[model samples]
Target chain A: MALTNHPSETPNLSFLKEKALQLRRLMLVQAAGKGQGYLGQGLGLAEFLATLYHYELRYDRDNPEWEDRDRFFLSTGHYSIALWAVLADIGYVSKESLPTYGADESPLEMSTIEGRVPGVEMTGGSLGHGLGIAVGAALGYRLSKRDARVFVEVSDGELQEGSTWEAATAANAFGLDNLVAFVDCNGIQADGAMVVPIEPVADKWRAFGWDVIEIDGNALDQVVGAMHWARMARGRPKVVVMRTKPGKGIARLEAREKAHFIRVGADEWDVIAKELEAENA
Target chain B: MLKGRTLGMGELERIEDRPFRTAPFAAGTLAAATRCDRLAVLTADLGKYTDVHPFRDAHPDRFFNVGMAEQALVSVAAGLAKTGWTAYCTTYGAFATRRAHDFLAIACAHGGAAVKMFAGNPGLTTGYGGTHQAIEDLALMRAIPDVTVIDPCDATEMQQIAEQAIDIPGTVYCRLLRGNVPVVLDPATYRFEVGKATRFGEGGDVGFVSTGFMTERCLDAARKLETQGVRASVLHVGTIKPFDAAAVAEFAGSVTRLVTAENHVLVGGLTSLVLDAMQEAQILRPMLKIGIPDRFIECGSVPYLQDKYGLTAARVHERVAAWLDRSGTSAAA
Candidate 1:
């Protein structure tokens, strides 16, 4: 199947990987500005966010509210740092607004608030809510006969919420083939590691009757390929189990303990950015 | 079992065929759906119970049953609204408020989605016990910022409110009463406004402030008290959240005594609202609250529950009469 609305005519893995590095650099700067934020999850899903926003998703940066644009819902709202980075790179938001994130009176809040930002579809600080709302929007699109699809990014830690399963069941029951869910399994939550262990997560979605695809989320090719496969699938909802490292690019941040909410000192942020730039070079 | 009373299989069939107060909701929604294609009817497996089966049947493509998941029901409705569709969903009041309150608050209210949530079996209207009843729903919904809280009194009011709620932008939580509802107010003259209370009768002795189905009971009590030489004015408050405090204060200023009645707990419902309004306006007078006290009511038949909680017209009349006798407030000529 042809990759619809891809930024490049041919599959350019190098360019896409560069885009991911750019997003990571932007996220690092945003987090460092706030002194603390959801840096780990944002860095981990950089490739997936870059692949979806730049390559796979069909969105008009000039007019974010265009009627027939594909919707991307960030279920793990703490990952607003990643979303704001992607939105700025795509011109949906100003590059200067990145530093004001998580500050008072700034629309670019720590968590995503719908309508406050251009690309944000819904407010998602509360876990287990995004997939259900995505299901509703998918159903709405099907009823309206709009050829737009909805891509929702959820966390593996969010699987603990009962409402997530409830939404999964309804998505399959309604046969929402237009809806695709990306479960970012970084394996780290607010209270340290997964206390109870929500392993075998792929089987859970498959049991709920979704077209499941597991992939290494940090790999640019696998993230883009899985999205294409999900868009081509029919007769059921789709889920891409994105198993990724908590900190993807930088070696120092990846090895650091307690990667959930990373608070690097002002000098350490410069080292992290230089490490990312050298690796890309 | 009782003398000359139908029981067993016959009683079951009779109750099943009994007309519910929620019929207007189904009929009104179906009527509204015909005109607006953007209208979608959704329920959390409460199609038959909430009387939304007709809309589901008519607009099968637009109808969605999200199983018994109230959280998904609310979140999905918010999602549908975000896509520029006016979505309406219904479920038991207990489930809507207690189970999926966060979703309703975040997805629908805070997001400012045009989702209308019609919650049924408010207060003592259900006989399935305390778990099935939602007594504190008004208090819970009223506390949410920017959510329009409505409690329709009867079938006509329910129909009018259900049709108009779709046009009222933002999230709305409307209390619904189903099964064998009474028609109390005259549809010809009664105008349903969002935050305005309508005065039913005039009197200078006392003001009978009421909301929801209890407004019907208060109207009856006012008529009965007229024969006893007590001129009691009736003010029916339908919208509870953006409450018409001015109308309430004007009505209270004209009367010597004030009595607040409701089909809910007296602590945080209409009585509390009227008391706050009176305090804000500094219009203090002799007041008596007649409704469920500060306690959890036991399960029983609707009539038994109504009488036990002093929710009936006769009970309201009795309470007002006793208070008048004690205060010696003379009747208005």
Candidate 2:
């Protein structure tokens, strides 16, 4: 399907960068409210989420389940903070609902649960599930002759699952050109730094018959450019290996040893908020 | 159609003795596919074995062979279901229930996606050992909320159940009796309901409640018990989850004794389900369970396994007769 609102005008790179910063600030605020969360991955994924929601993806804020809408599946479901920030910013979710994240009986769960919340395509957190679903959605769309595309955001650690490779093989075998996968290579997992190395990640995807694009994910220009390039690639599924900083735009959080899960004090949150305000100014 | 390559009269006669149970499944799916354009069939490279080949042949555009990734097979079906399509996925019972259970639970059942999973070679139907057998599939699938679990008794029920499964709102895990299935139930008067038990015969001494292929054995056992002057009733409980508690309680209340038969393990299967239902209903009776014990079954032919696991009709009759004698209900006949 042709993109409904393709940025015919040259995208204002500076505007998107500001949006990315805003998303990161919102993610930090949400995590701070919960006392702890998957803050690092959320922070790292801010730029891509911001770029996709604002400048790239074809979606209706009012109609999240529109038949022809481009699907953005958060394969790394723990990065709900990042997705929530984008959704709230795009006005798909109420900005007031951001503080209720991770609370009991709240729609804003610590991990993404699809069907419960609007704009969330599928439930994630059990890694390696999203891409396979994306492949299916892509196939479903193709069968229905709908031009809708499916984009899945997977993490570097999620590659360890054999199912991920299985999905990669199927996507290529089916020639799902409408499917795009973003591997968030943030370099950390629940058990600390990745114990098993999955280096030469692009080679693995390329060998599996996917169109691989490696880039510094934190860079707004590269993130936007790669997305455009992916949309044009035909006859193969696309993967953008996003090398991102664990905690971007925050000095203290970035320097923490255990960056996978983060816990911040009430006092530290205030300091972080002030720092973010200064950066914005 | 070459005459030389065709099967001889004796071979043809042998083929008639062994009914292809999966034939009805393929025919039913093909019939459903013709009516519903949104229906899709997926397999983990077991389409031919599971008899989804007919659907694949009839509707090539809507069929998917996921090439042996059971997890992908399930999750992909979920994805297809999410897009407002009814997805029917097939694989071996062991692989579908054991390997991709999490995907079935989280993706399909949790969201109440319209995905039907047909699992072939249930329990001792395959001689490929413990790795291939799905003795615990019932317990596992039953634990998942919003999943409709069905174990059809024979080929006729298999087709009817497959046709009915498409209309069931959420995910369904059906235990398929694949190749050479026996014809036990008559379709003329037998209507398959989702959660209702079908009572085939009537007696007062013992209630022989069974599920799956064991239901066929129970009917046979009941007939044999009649010859021995032991009156026995036969109740086939096809749907495991959303169990027919009222029917079971009614049957238990009518009989002086109860005997449960199944192809699965005695624990957490038909026996456990019946016991739990009877206990809840306060219909207490001396119960004897005839099924695979709490252990892995050895690799063997179907007849050997059936005999070893005490799943044969004669064994059911023997166990029920013994239970009647021990409980002092033998004279109730």
Once superposed on the true structure, which residue ranges of model 1 sit more than 4 Å away at CA?
Answer: A1-9, B1-22, B330-333
Cα misplacement distance, residue B63 of candidate 2 (Å) = 1.4
List the global CA lDDT of all models.
0.85, 0.84
> Share of real interface contacts recovered by each model?
0.72, 0.50
DockQ of each: 0.81, 0.70
Residues A28-117, candidate 2, lDDT per residue (tens digit)? Answer: 768887988888888888889878887878887667778888888898888898889988898778888888889999899999997777
The local lDDT score (0 to 100) that residue A128 gets in candidate 1 is 89
**Number of the top TM-score candidate:** 1
True contacts kept of 2: 0.50
Worst 10 residues of 1 chain B by lDDT: B6-15
Best by lDDT: 1
Highest-scoring model, DockQ: 1
Displacement of the residue B93 alpha carbon in candidate 1, Å: 0.6
